[model samples]
Target: MGTSASKLAILDIVLNGLMRRYKERVPDVGIILDAMVSDGIVKSTSDIENDHIAFRTMGVPQLGVKSFEKIFLHFGYEKRDHYFFEGKKLDAWWYSPPRATDPRIFVSELRVGDLSEESQHIIHSYTNEVTVDGIATDPVDYLDLDNGEAVDAFLHQPLWRTPTTADYQSLLQESEYAAWVIYNRYYLNHFTISVHNLPEGYNTVASFNDFLEKHGIKLNTSGGKIKVSPDGGLLQSSTVAEMLDAEFANGEKLRISGSYVEFAERKVLPEFASLPAGEIKRKHRRDGFEAGNADKIFESTYTTQTGR
Candidate 1:
């Protein structure tokens, strides 16, 4: 079969898998699955698309994700990119905070391609160092209250300070779920994946080893991803309309979420073009170096001068 047909056929299989699982396990695991599926922040080439941050830092109890189908119908399904990952699709739904922007709600569809290198680097850096508590401690920990305490309470720290091949293998020997989560977050930071649409491919399935190498990129052969659509699913109308807005549509508005319009109008817009500049020359000089450029330094003695 053709690549597209193969992809779509695999999607059908994934959808069936999700449906069957949902039927079997909704009452038991639906809530957890719903939150995880809906609260996704990073966008892969394929996974869950149309992540509408209805509430910014101040609103939602946790970062939430849900499909438009689930929002409108309370029923949804997940699919696969091709034949990559298995059993990775989700049909669950979640509830997030209400919007504070225009009466009409807007959803932002951010693809892996849309992020800057610095942003990607931060994500990558944090992924390895971050623990579940570290990640959830700030916002979700404060927001999601279960009997005045955080839900899903679990201490999360990096399995290894510096992961090698052996580290990954060792992680696999531990909880596979935790390993995959770390892998996914780390992968999200380094590479750029396309998120063109939904009902198609949502997350890339390429293996990390292959990604590091120059071989062909591979989608997950086991787990499935959410669907993609050219129009960005429900975001087409909301985000596309933002593009048409006279004041905010011009790319500056691109970074700010629609939910933050009030904050933008009152605070962010005034400081929109403002940036603080600091001189690094003195800091560098203070760290120690004679005013001479050297082509080479002692490899053994080369060191960053420390601040007094």
Candidate 2:
């Protein structure tokens, strides 16, 4: 397949795999995604250019960002700048795509050691379960990666046993990040729509937020409705995660917040756009993500935000 074809094929596999598993827990993905198309948000799923997709993982010895990033690296993505969140205990890195049109990848790992001892033990117990089961595998196999099966397997694989209600409560009290990864292992946290590519009236995050709210979608308002970078190069907003039923190890089913979608609009740098078209050597749009922006976006799935 050609570059565009190959990108779409991989995305199809990832999105389908994610939605399948995500819908098992939360049904809003299909509802919102389908509505976006049916309501003319974009021509179709294929026409929606993604700015990035994010994954959340535990920062344990065996499993974390390192293991998860291999899948993208095999597909020819290169690691880019790193971001740190002191309050959230997260360390993330965004990867540059092999092809410019391909959506960028963002993966963040919770610093397990930084949490309270009880929270750390609860998280480690689950990561240990995944490690013992040998669910972790190399994502660099050419045949499997090219065919998109490997990526699907990686995303859908269960890396941890269910957490007990008591343990989950303990983790949640200390760090909502820990609670999230323990229950939802290796699932797509959120996928972003490139707002800059949207049609004239909807090309900005503000307008897109207006459109989403009109459809009854609630957005994260922790920092603000829209999180803008200090330099005003990146603006972002996200829907509050939908709450869904989750069965714990103790045989208790309870409602919990699940994944949500995000929107981003990257502004063109004045210096870059002012250059003659042929003379511009670098990408015109702001390239990296803002740590402050992402920190608030991560809270979209928190119980306090989702109110599950």
Candidate 3:
């Protein structure tokens, strides 16, 4: 799929905004880039191809995949496969880029109603604040998607009131994903690194992981250091979430999960094995995601991984 140059320009601005803030919030982004440059992985950060970027949402009528997807769709992204994480009480989807050079998008939403009544109440008490005239609101409905500045601001802006420490803790006990969305509304969750493109010695998750550990970067060990797809076509790993000194309501302070970096290695498809290395392209590689891999990847932000 393709869009007009004007729209593409706006998309660039919006994506740049998301990544800029993401890198700032997650220090590992810069740490990894700087180390990569020093180690001759590439000349600079620009040489690393972004595999994908992800976001989390509250699965309510006001905002979720149905509402948040309009922004990218307007910019020419085509919605592809849908993934459901029953254990996490979430639903997710992946969107293909308008151009091969752009990163894919992975967005997931919390199934609020599935939570315990108390947990649901705590989430609604805050999420319910995002309203105008007592009716649920879809924040993106008012955005001029073509206006890059406004959209960029919206991505970083808070949609609800600050969550109280008690409410946040209660939700966290039941669903870490819920607690995350409650505080970090619409913040880019994680941006991925396509390790397969790096110089030969650092071209796989295993090798890149060793490089990261040597530089003091922490890896999420929820499922294992590496979460591989059943077919062995996709392998992944991520940094344990960076903890932030969060300030909740009433001056309550606690260290909370922020964001993290993910590394992905998508092996070339079997059918494309005969293709010449110079001739192979993104299409010849494993496409889309594997739910089994993503399920563990989600824990990158969970306390289980972050606390490690």
Candidate 4:
């Protein structure tokens, strides 16, 4: 395969693995992705260019942002700007890709210290059970940059022990972030499609939302269906996560919201709008994420938003 083709193949393998695990948890991902293909929005899964993929982690001494990010860093992704969500108690950062075709990465960790002591104890109890030092050692074993299998393994590795139903309910009352990570572990929380790369008439988030709604997908309306950046260069929307059955550590099974997909439309900068469409590249478009928009989008999997 050519260089571009080789990169696409690697991305395809990574995405397919992530999607398989995601679909196993949230069936709607298969429904939505299949519809995207059958409806002609994307000729095939490989045709859709992902703007970014997000992961959620716990902010603890051992397995927070630093440990998890090592895998992506091994793959040549560089850390970028930091974003803080006071209400959500999250500290996040976006990673730039080594290659233009590779998707950007956004990762956020729940500030365990910000939570009540009781909540912190509940979270740490699980983290402590998983690793003696609270730091994850799985990713360290797979630090080979060329090992695509290692990257895939790191993405789906289980990082903590499941919590009891009572503990989960308690965590939910205090911090949904805590409850989510306990169950979902290091799975891909969401992946965004680059709407700007879509064909005309469907290149905007509004139009894409229409297409998703037409297929019976319900979107998260926490801060309105579309969250726009201050400069109006970045637009985003996500479907409320599908509810999935979860068996607590106590053996009580309950239906809870799982991961969801995201759509992003990045407009060309004012300076680039005058250039021909063919002349525009990824750098010409809005490249970074917006805190205001991401803050709302983060609710896509919350019970309040997903109605689970």
Q: For this target, which candidate reaches the highest TM-score against the unseen true structure?
A: 3
- Clashing pairs for model 4 are none
lDDT of each: 0.22, 0.80, 0.92, 0.83
Q: For model 3, how does the per-residue alpha-carbon lDDT over 151-237 read when each residue is reduced to its tens digit?
A: 999999988888898888888998999989898999999999999978888989999999999999999997899999999999999
Q: In model 4, how large is the Cα lDDT of residue 81?
A: 97
CA error at residue 185 for candidate 1, angstroms: 5.4
Q: Give the TM-score of candidate 2.
A: 0.87
Comparison by lDDT, 1 against 3, better one: 3
Candidate 2's C-alpha runs over 4 A off are 1-16, 19-26, 132-147, 274-282
Off by over 4 Å in 3: none
Going through the candidates in order, what is the number of backbone clashes in each?
Answer: 32, 0, 0, 0
The all-Cα superposition gives candidate 4 an RMSD in Å to the true structure of 3.1
Structure candidate 2, residue pairs in collision: none
Which stretches in model 4 have alpha-carbon errors above 4 Å? 1-16, 132-146
What lDDT tens digits, residue by residue, belong to model 2 across residues 1-308?
23356766775676567657765655555666677788787777777777888899888866788877877776667899999999999999999877676778899999988888878877877776653336543333332666676678867767667788888888889888888888887788888888887677888999989988887889899899999999998999998997877889868987877788899998878877777644533268898899999999999999778982
lDDT of 1 by residue, 75-190 (tens): 12222111111121111222321221101112211221223454334334433343355553333333222221111121111222433333333433432222233322211111
Any runs in candidate 1 off by more than 4 Å, and if so which? 1-93, 100-160, 182-308
**What's the lDDT for candidate 2?**
0.80
